[model samples]
Target: MRRRLPAVLALPVAASVLALAAGPAAAQVETTPVPAPGNPGAPPASAPASPQPLGHAVGDAGTGLAVIRVLPNSTPTKAILPGAADKLPKQAAVELGFGLASAQANSEAYLAYEKSIAQASPGGIAVQGSSPQAPGSLAQTAPPNNEAPLTGGINPPSTPLDTLVKVGALNGSVSANWSDALGPCVDTISDASTSIASISALNAIPTLPGGKDLTGAFDAPNLDEAADNAVVEQLKNLAGPLSTLGGILGGQGSAGGGSVLSLPNTLSARSVVKLVDIPGSPNKAVQSTSTLQVAALKLLAGTPFEISINVVSQPTLQVTSTGDAATSAVQYTAPVLEVTQGGKSLGRLDAANPKLDIPISLPLPGADDLPGLGDLGKLPIVGNLLGDGSPLRDALSKDLQKLDLGVLRLAVAGLNQTGAAATQPFKGYQLGATARMVDLQVLPTEALGLPNLPSALAQVSLGEQVARAYAPEGGVVCGTASAPQAPPAPAPQGSATPQLAYTNAAYHSVPLFWTGTAMLLFGVVLVAALPTRRRKTTD
Candidate 1:
């Protein structure tokens, strides 16, 4: 009967090279011209000549700095074999050279080994061989034949292979376990597979021993081969939309949010008046003029707009006085036109028409015969005080400087209101204006109830309304001759009667009904959409 082997009993044999091939096979025999032991085949060809000993003078000079003699049991001395003095010195030099060369070679070998190990073990090394030294350490115990057993056993030992397999299995197991633990974490990374591939490629190339030259190693073709492999691995394992999602989220975190508003022109209060000439008047011409005064105008949006009007025909005149002759003084007079706005008026005589009057005044000279002194005749204090430059002149000049009103027509539009019913109310009405020569056209509303509506309408309408209501009454009106002058107030006993102030006609009541209804609807929708939360369990 045939005897069957259990898997465990066979594992030791099966896992090892011994099970595959019987010990010390005939093929292991060597058939080469081997070097003799005592001679070691004339010294290795690359060995150099021994350094000469220093002479007396040189030795004395080098006493402290130079190595006089190696200690008896030091590493270098013990490394030499006994009874081989003449050959020992040469052998020692050869061994020293061999050691240096071997170290460099070993450093390169170790780097390659480490790289191989990292690639094979994605997790890490699980088990290492008993010796920390590299595989080269076993070479000393082996026969001249390269097929010698590493552990010197009749049958090759299974320990090294077993350790290697165990390490490989452990690495695989750890990698799998770690993947399970970190599955959620991978979702958060934008390029998880690419990052893993990069790390693996970095770890594959081993670290060289300290002081070894590494510059040439990086240039080796093997490094490029390994990098290509890593790239292939990364491409194969790309995560589906996670990479895109992560990039989008990252970008959003870098930018923020706000609101911006741009208005066509600033809104302000102004005074306006229209003068129309009656046809066939004795003055011999039909003419019309619109005057406006803008005051205390705070800018609500951007730069304020400016307009100017030309008075078609007016003549210039000069005034002068002649005195110093005993008992006789000559005074000069000139005709002046009055311009008024908001109860403030100025009279100017000898103002040259067809010229742009900025409606502003400047300082005047003491000489009454000054050329432009005639122009000053239309100005407030300048015309009234004649030859004097008084405090009133300064005050009026300041007020005029602040009056920056563009032409009334330029700032407003002429809508065809002729057909509008006299009794109709203009609720929610919109207005627009255009200054064709100035190349500016603003439509207050193309659509109602838009966010920009309030601002647009205010730009055109606010100034127009203020101008219409507040322009000063030009000529005085007298009621029937018998109408008595308003009675003078009696002296106050303790305090005088409070004056009744006129209410502004522009102020209107806002419609609160529609606003409240819209707000209620919004609140209802918001409440309906909110998620309902359940209460926690008592247990």
Candidate 2:
């Protein structure tokens, strides 16, 4: 209609315009980076003897945790950056460690040491008893397995931690292994050591006499100095706990097989616990900084660290009992233990994470939903994708796609961007948690070389409950538990003081006896030094 402006005429003009636009950039000469020549005198090098990290106490516990958390996934997120930020992925992580520790220099240990029981018992009773009413529940609830607190008094010990937690479902793990040594530590290098390269690395490391690696913690950026101090103290105080953890993880006492147990095993009641690795929507998060155990502390040797072999969770763990609870007059009960993961797909740490996301029904609820999802407006993801479809189908399609995290965000812009949309749920920046019942039984009856505290035991109780409750639904599977029935009441009344059912007494008892004897001698000296004759004359 407009005098046929030669359709072909536009091509030359466009080519000319493109050439002009690209001329300057194309005219520039290409340049390649020239690598500097290597010196022939430079000795052939491979790598450091100990591949070290430049870290924190538990900060190092993550093991390969840094590899997964430090890098941002290659995906689009709501908090996405414009340039380099987008190129480098973003993520966040928090650690929750449940350490069973005792005081470093416990005085009560002496009393328990010198004081003898009527019988010799080792290993607390496993908390398993038949529910008088239910047979299958026999393993579920048992009285014979019940164990009492190591320290007995009006007030029991409690854990020494202050905790904070949140929730999100993601792939994570719940592990238990004390013997597993932490990554090799450098004695010459402190957490503050700035010189990454060190020839003294090997000489810096001390020989592990106990076949255990005792080293300083990794250098971490966010960890506070006080927290580091606490970690060191925990290492010292909880040496016994660490060893116990090692044993449990190693399945030492179990005549059967292993100690690391997980839940929903879906297997026989008999078997060593396995590593339960599965994607769970716990959305559960927990954190702690407390390490004080009763009147004593358990930190020493910088901090505690351990390793792992990915294993499945075995619900049934073997409990080694020395004798009958009725005879010992001491019993124990199983406290609820759980692990979970959860998260709200919020944009970034700078913004609040999304808690609940409800997909919209079609009929075009709004422009935000699927294509022609509602009567509100056209989303046009595929250019009026459902231009001729039914509203019901549109709504159904929108909802179905949501099951996939990737589609959910696009279908609705409100979704949080922390999670990776891969097929696996655990593939995102989400939360992981562990829970255990903090009872005296869980604490080693024998302090080993460390001070034992009953107070700290109670403190960990809540943490265990929290970990156990870390469910996909974001609520405790088993609500807060009642006080454990362990260290049970005498099923048969006998006035004899129940003997302690613990091993390694002889090895750990020396220090206690030495301390007790020293006090006894001091008392004798004071009594003998008194002059009775002088007092009579003065009266």
Candidate 3:
């Protein structure tokens, strides 16, 4: 009983692993909940003829910020097991990188501008000043320049009176108009900067574990990834142009214009991180098994952690957009999800009613070489005696089981999915992120005495509509394969059947053990009874 204590104690660890695994898996979650602010009350239309201009570009503009989170576990987890998971490790791949950025509407007043870009291009602007550009004939009639030879102290012909008025009128008009417009333009720039900073601060915020304190400029998101994912589809369509622009502007996009147009620009955002120590809990009942250890640092999504993250994005109202006012809309499309193998789309995820399943794979350590089993086996009497019931095997199994490699790997996978980014409003300085979905599964080839494969995902909603999600054939979104596939049911003609997943649970063979016990008992009874007397015994 004493010898088996370790295994008995470790049994809970295994159960906890299963329980944790079976625990509901959370979906791709937004780390930052955009802070809800009482609007900084919209600036008055036009300040009473002041030197400074009014609200930025009064042609109708708005600002927004989305706060996503950084997965601090990304780097360390990757180091532990490389290529086993993807936190969307790379992007800026297509048009999809920039959008699916949901306009989370809080009040009815702000809903209208949720999807609208802050810088208004045009849909009939309201300008109160004269045209800064002079008209072709009367506006720009500069008298012809006459080159005349100059004598030592003599000058050429007297200036024409008509030319003087024309020049004076044009100059006066231009100077006055520009002066008035200058203030507003500067105000607009200031507004844009404030918006950028606010968004950046919101997206890359840090917090205590389990999101405690929540101290930041942003809020904890009640947002969904599906909705956000849906928004991304529109973005992917523009990948062609973005990729093209990158080429024209020179591929080094991380440094201002050098990489402004580049595709797949990586963004890392680490700052104000400190060495944290974590105490390990061996089990719920028996919590601290190890001493305090250094903890992993956290990073917020969309902030710059590396110099390479420098991207070129600038906001402007220089060019007015021309569009039909009749074409105004309040509708926006979201991204879709799909599963593909060899570039062939197998099926699509329902955007309206989205469901995502991620497989959490953990590489299990094999029983290849036992440290002392070989030496013990070589011993004379002990080797033969300890054949199948080796204590060493039992101890090793307990130790190996206690390590919980799978669970650790699962944590890493979750971290890899830590951060995600939206294309800044104007593709500004903070352009893209290296974040991606943590899809690589590290599965152990063999079972580690688990009762049933635990469900690896929490049932958290990723508060956004999605266009398409790429997944494996069986939509095991967040757990290891627990069972085998069952035979397909017959379906009606031409209709695609829903892809269903099935897993087999490990169970004890109660009936088989009972039946064997009964047989042995019967044989013992017969031997004791001695139905007939033996030949040597007198009958």
- Reference-based TM-score of each model: 0.12, 0.14, 0.18
Lowest-scoring 10 consecutive residues by lDDT in candidate 3?
A: 284-293
lDDT by residue for model 1 (87-159), tens: 3321111100000000000001111111000000111110111111111111111001112111211111233
Model 2, stretches more than 4 Å misplaced?
1-94, 99-314, 319-539
CA-lDDT, candidates in order: 0.17, 0.19, 0.19
Return whichever of 1 and 2 wins on TM-score. 2
By TM-score, the best candidate is 3
Compose the digit string of candidate 3's lDDT tens values, residues 193-258: 110111111110111111211122112133244433422232222212121111111112111122
| lDDT score, candidate 2 | 0.19
Residue 405 accuracy (lDDT) in model 2: 7
Q: Where in model 3 is the C-alpha error above 4 Å?
A: 1-68, 71-329, 337-350, 363-539
- In order of TM-score, best first, we have 3, 2, 1
In model 1, the runs with Cα more than 4 Å from the true position are: 1-268, 272-416, 419-462, 466-479, 483-539
Error of 3 at 231 (Å): 39
